[model samples]
Structures are given as C-alpha cells and as structure tokens.
Target: MQRITSFFRFCRGRAKLKRRAAAMGFMNHHHQTAISSGQEGIKTVGVDNHNLCDFSSNSDLCICIVTWNMNGKVSYEDLAELVGSSRKFDLLVVGLQEVPRDNILRLLQAALEETHIVLGKAIMQSLQLYVFGPKNSDLLVKVELQVDKHSVGGFGGLIRRKKGAVAIRINYKGFRMVFITCHLSAHASKVEERNCQCKHISHSLFSKNWNPYAKPAHITVWLGDLNYRIQGIDTHPARNLIQKDLHGTLTSNDQLLQEAERGHIFNGYCEGTLTFKPTYKYNVGSSKYDTSYKVRVPAWTDRILFKIEDAKKINATLRFYESMDDIYSSDHKPVKAHLCLKLNKLLSA
Candidate 1:
C-alpha cells in the first residue's frame, strides 16, 4: 500500500481501475522511469553458469518465475511476455495480489489454450498463484495448493488478505519444487511485521499437504511484493540517486536482504543480482518515479528469489533476470527471472 504521508496529496490522474480495485486497490499505478531489459533473443544453449551447470547440458526442464502485484489491473500483453506463446519455459510460476476473481485469468488461459499450455491457478483471498506449462510435457506428477490468512483486517474478517500467502508445491519427473507467493504487511516501518508473516509462511504453509515426504523442496521459489522500503536516508537524496542510476547503494539498507543475512527471514533463500531499478510506487503509463505527495522512496517491492539445497545435484542456474517496464498496469512494476533447474531424483529417495 502506498501510504502517502499526511503532508502529501493523492495522485491517480483520471484513470479508473478495473475489477478488484475498490478494496485491494490501495496502491495506484506509477508513471516513473522503469528499468527495462533487452528483449529475449535467440538464446543459445550453453553449459555455462548463465544457462545451467554441466548436468543440464540437455536442459531437461526450464522454469520461468514471475511476480506481480496487479493492483486490480490486467494486461494480456504482460501475460504473453511473461510465459511467451511459444512455450519457451517448461514451467511458468506466476504470483499476483489483489486479483478479486478469475474472470481475466480465464481469458488469459483461453488465449494460451490455443498454444496447448495447461493452466493451473489458486487464489487465497487477495493473493493468487498460477502455474502453466506445455500441455504434453507430462512432467507434472502432483500439484498441492495451500493458503493461509495470517493477518486479520477489515471489520469482522470481511477481507481476508490484509496479510497472507498462497503456495503450490509441484512434483515433476520425480523431482519436487515448492513455489510460494505472498503479500506481506506493507509500508516502510513494518519490517518486523513483514518478517513475522514470512516466518509463518516458511513454517506452517509448507505442511504435509505440500509434500508427502515432509522433505524440503529440491527447488524453492519465494517471491512477491515483500513491501521492504528504504531506511536511514532522505527521500529527495534517494530519488536523486535513483534518477542518476546509483540504485545499487540502496540494497545495503534493504530490510529483506539484511534480515536474510542475519537468519531472521528468508533464511535459506537467495535472490539474484538486482541489476534493474526498484519496481515500486510509479505513475501510470510513464517513466517517472512515485510522483505522489507521499513520495514513497523507491524500493524493490516486487521480487522473485529462490533457494536450491543441493545445487550440485539439482543445479539451479539463472539465465536472465529483469523487470518489465512497459507493462504499467499497476503502481508496481512486474519482476521476472528465467531459470534452468535440474530435478534431483535422490531428494525423494
């Protein structure tokens, strides 16, 4: 949520948000300068770290992880760009917040149906996760979806998504991967509260339903609008640095990474290098920063981080990591990571 300070005025231009806006539309779309990446060209299959380890020389499976806080907005182009019509990625894991219902999702699936990609979706209050892949890939053995509403808000528990997580664990070709997308408490000052929700997600959400063996997933991806904001700095200076491309300095104070380093949250998870600018608090249809009165300092709220316990056995390599700039349907920019993962059969043995 873009909690603009009392001193600042609200700004949304003259645009009206579509469905799932009234209640969960607390944050509007941004028009700030977005950090874009090069369009995916013909990727060469190399055994280097950029693609995968020596094990995946054949690249048995490739997965693309995307996370977006839709803020009640929908754009078909964004979906197409994410998974691609050609079905380049074997598995597409998507996480979205504030998607009220499945209307737009159904349409998106229908569009992909022509391409023969099977769609699977799960919604928990305001949080949702969608998994799709080539129809005849036949790698899918089991899919387990879990939802937990950890924070209660809105009178009498009317709105169940103030703080919660939705997760799905998949067993493919005798290998397991648990994918989680969560909407934690927002705002800059509530770092500890967000950490608490993360703890709940790590412990309880991965119950027996996710895996019959109770063993951790060979590959685990945790991503979403984690809501970690900048600290120990003035807004004007941070904005100036970001505008000038000195964004890397801000990560040192990032609550999420720091907490992970100290074993407070995301203990075993690892995030790829954040080469792109922060994906939050932007104006709609423009390349400008959060121009609202609250002037929320730019922070990497939307993210896709992962962890692989045995990198040697299941080799998880990041081919490309970037933030989509053109899809300005929400105040937060969508972040995506392309990965090559090997499923270790021994994990289940």
Candidate 2:
C-alpha cells in the first residue's frame, strides 16, 4: 500500500526538467516534459520531479509487477486500466515485449504521473523495463541507482534487439534489490533455446565486472514474456482445458516449471500459482485463442518470479496474481502480481 506525504508543492516550472524533456522527441512539443534528463543517478520522469513518499521506517513495502507482450500494438486509451487501480502500490515495475513504438513510454508516464515518479527505464529495441516509485518518497533517490541491459538472441547478432533483457538495480536504505525484465525466444519447440537465454541472462546481466563490490541482490524479481509453452498436450486438448477453466491441469506440463525444477533455468525462483488461463496466442481484440491456420497453442508466456537472499531476514508474501481480461488490444493478456515485503524496521531503515 502507498503512504501519503505532505512534501508536495506546485512550482511554476523547473528548467532542468524542461531541458530533459527535449530528449524524448517522440513526445509532441505541446506536451510537457515527461522523461528524465538522462544525466547522473536515478533520473526522475514525468511532471513531478518532487521527492517520493517517505519510506523512512521499517514498513511493509508493496510492489506491483506487470508483464505484457503487446504483439507490436499498443492501446493508448487502455493505458490507465492496464496499470490497474485496484490498490495503491509503493513501487510499480512493468515489463513489455514486442513493443512497437517508444512513444508508449511517454503515454504511460502521463498515466501514472499523479501517484508515481519514474525511477528510470531500460530499453532494448522492443523489450523494455519501466520502474516507478511512490511520489514524494526519497527512499529510492537517496542511494545510487544502476541500469544494465543485455540481448541474448539473433543469428550472429542480426536481430539481437528483438530478444533481450533490461534491468534496474537500487540499494534502497541498504536493502539491495534488482528488477529484471526480459523477452526470450518464442514457440513451443524452442524450450532449450529459452532455457539457454535465461541462463545467459542470469550470468551476463549485472555481471561482477560491472559492479565493483560484486554484491548479490538481496531481492531479485525476474519477469517478462518467457515464451515457454505447455508440453504433453496439443492445441485442441489445451483449448478444452482452458474452456473448462482447468488451468491447473495445463500448468502440470509447463516447460518453464519443468526446467526450473530440474535446475536448468531460473533455479530457486518462486512464482505465484497459475490460476488464470494462458495469456498468449489469442486472436487480437477477443477472448478466443489463435484462430489462424497455425492455431497457436495457448500458454502462460508472460510471468513474474522473485527470489530473496534470506527469508529469515526479510518476509515476502504474494498478495494477489491475476490477468486483465478487459484489455483486448494485444493478442496476449497482461498479467500482474502484488507482492508485500515485511522487514525488520532497522533493516529497512
């Protein structure tokens, strides 16, 4: 949940934000600057450059992670609903795959400006990771922030940007946290390829060479369109189970789960139960699955998983996980999770 702060005030205009606004040419001139100046540590985005809500004491830290594969399309009108208002969150992390345009960032920033301050974004072509913290909170900006990006697919680096990962790391009040969002190889047959990509991303991203201290993240959340499909079932049976609301039956054969169980990829990570239907390969603008000749099998392609260094030190709880069915702009539905972290007051201080 979000905490209110009394530190907000209306200023005419800040020249720093104005100069930074010119960098995002995708925005119209009439639009006020909605992006960071791309300068030193933790650039704030959107109209509110003021401090975020104070998280100064040991408190339950609420985070919301959303992952969506746009399928090269974006619905500006649905942006508000996409970032749900069911509950207030202290932090918002969004991972997108197959993003067609960069202007969507400006649009999303405008949508969340009232409640959040954009910490920053990591983008590699169509793959993007956006991080936002509570408004008027100095908890995020008081320390150094790091951004890293790496791409894992492509033949001889031909389309490297098409598949890759982006990350944002921050040591907030000595509690190190890393948020990574990635888009891996597609298709049901590319199980090995996706696993390899996950391994490569794990090893390559924020490598020891990049961090002088070589510190491991206290909490790491990896989320995005992983593209792992359900195994041991065809399109017809999978559809039947989905139609019957038996998602648990299909998840039994999920490639990502099987591989993770075998320690092949994302080992030791934990995900919320798959109670919702598969979020991929749907007919655009409809609830129906793929109707093309290929008849792509539906699967839980988009996901969010997290790991904490020591459960004894910090407590983690998954409050809720569900998909947004109303948003029909993309072939794949958007999935979101609400996570609550309880820590000792002194540790979070």
Candidate 3:
C-alpha cells in the first residue's frame, strides 16, 4: 500500500510540472511573436492622449522600472549598473526625486545613447518620470504626460518639496499604462499623512485629463521614496534586527502594509517580496546605518508598487527587487525593480 501511495505522489508531481511547462511555453510564444514595429530612427511626439483604444494589439511588452531619491546628488557613474541587465525589455521607466532636474535629464539621454534607447517623454523637474524604448520601435506610441506637484514638506506645503507625483501614459500594442513616481511625506510618526498624500496623488493622476482612458489608466505604476517606516519598535531594536539580517521579519510592522490592510491607501496594488536590507538612513559611502545623534532606524522607505485592472487579463512577473548599495552618493541607496509582463489569451486574440 505504501509503495502504491508513493507512486501516485510521484505521478501527481510530474503532472503539475507538465502543466506549468505548457503554460510557460504559451507565454514565450506570445513574447517572441512580433505584432507591430514602428518606423526606424528617433521619433518624438508631443504629449498626446488622443489616440488610445484604437491601436493594434499583439506581442509581449516587457518593461523595466527604477525609482530613486538622489538627495540632491545624481551619479552618472553606475547608470548602466543601475538597471543591471536590460534582457531586451521593450520599455524602461525611471522615476526620481530630489535630483538635479536638467543635468540628470541630460545624463540619461547621454547614457542611454550607448544602449540605443530613445526618450519617449521630456523630463520634469525634481519629481521626474522618464520613458525610454528601443529606437525606432513603433509598438509604443501616442505618449502623453500629466504632472501634478503638491508640496507636502517645507514651508507649510507651499514650497515644491516632497512633492506629489509625475505621470506618463503610453499605449503599447494596445496596452495602456500610466507610470508615476512620487516623493511623499517623511518621518516615522507621519504614517497618516503619507496615506493622505497617497490618496491625493492617486486622485490627481486619474483626474488630470479629460480622456477616459487617460484618467482611469489600465495599468498604474507607483514608485518612489514612499517614506514608509517600521513601526511599534524602538530604534535600537529595529537596527539590531536589521544587523541580524532579519529584514523580512521587520516588515510585519511596515507602515505601508498596515495602511493597505486597513483599506486606507493603495487598496489593490501589489509589491514584490523585499529580500534586501533596509535602503534608507544609511551613512554616505558606508553600509552602516545612521550613527549620528539622531540615530535613525533603517527602513525600506524607497519602494515600488503596481495596480492593474482586469487582473485575469494580464500578468506581472517580478524578475528582481533589491537595492544598489554600490552607488553610494546619498543617505538612501537607490532601489531597483525588474518586471516581465505578459498579456492573456483574451487580450492577444
């Protein structure tokens, strides 16, 4: 009897593997299949949301998105290493905060030249959202920009500091996506305020334009220095947990997750599992956490989140999610996320 039971278990496991293999094979077929390609050479169009719900649909659209807070310092040194490997992703989205607006934009344009990627949208100040795609790729077009800057810090929300967010929407082979990068309120005790900021930013992005597709974007991406912290623990305990490489355990008290569970912010967005050390409050040029009079507890304040409509119709696969400690110009190390996306049979059909 025991032998028969073991035989059945092995058979079941083999069947599951076969099913997974078949599903993956189907996805690869769509990714490799070319649905459309634009005219060759660099093509820059004005921000136009007038041409959505009318583009042809085909092929897999792979996207890579990176978000960082420069702390008023931008490094062109590890720009290539920032995204690590492209893996032939069709699109690249960069969201930034506290950066040199003009020079950083120029740096991106120059650095991207090596990869032969061209800008899809112009760079905005401080809070920046940039779109890049394969040169001469016509699969993604009809790009549009909507920027909303609401001061949440400094001088009673009057100055342009820790601002709201910047967003850019584009249609890729009939896929609609709105990419937004924002810098919310800081400090540990301001969780409610951060939640409010999130609500405000969400409303601003979805309501900035009159176009229906423009407002209620199909796939919305929110990434930046969100400033969420670990709560219900003293600074020393948090630091000790981080020192012991127990970052995963510390996330139980993450303010952002708590807010989401309470249905107060980012109700439907999903975040990839964070497997890296805390990315904030680091000493410049050192792996050690802040060692000053104000010993700030290390936290994963810098993060990336995503929201989607018709979840059954599309799939998001996270290839990697971690921080870049090598690029050490700011107190908060830059964090990165790589995502491989696919459309379902209904969308493809």
Q: Which predicted model would earn the best lDDT? A: 2
Ten-residue region with minimum lDDT total, candidate 3? 38-47
Predictions: Cα RMSD each: 11.9, 17.8, 17.9
Which of 1 and 3 is ahead in lDDT?
A: 3
Clashes of each: 15, 8, 1
CA shift of 5, model 2, Å: 50
lDDT digits (tens) for residues 1-349 of candidate 2: 0110111111113223433554654433322221232212111112111433233233367788999888777767677887866436777889888887648788888888778878878888888888888878767658567888877644223223378799998766466789999888777766656765676677778775575756677789989988899878889998998899887788778988776655556655778888889998888999899999999888999988888877777877676678888889898999988776777555543
| Whole-structure CA lDDT of model 1 | 0.66
Tell me each candidate's TM-score: 0.76, 0.79, 0.76
Q: Considering TM-score, which of the candidate structures 2 and 3 is the better prediction for this target?
A: 2
- Can you tell me which runs of candidate 1 are displaced by over 4 Å? 1-57, 100-102, 140-162, 208-213, 343-349
lDDT of 2 at 85: 61
Residue 217, candidate 1: Cα error in Å is 1.3
lDDT of 1 by residue, 54-91 (tens): 32455667777888887766667766765555556677
What lDDT does model 3 reach? 0.67
Worst 10 residues of 1 by lDDT: 6-15
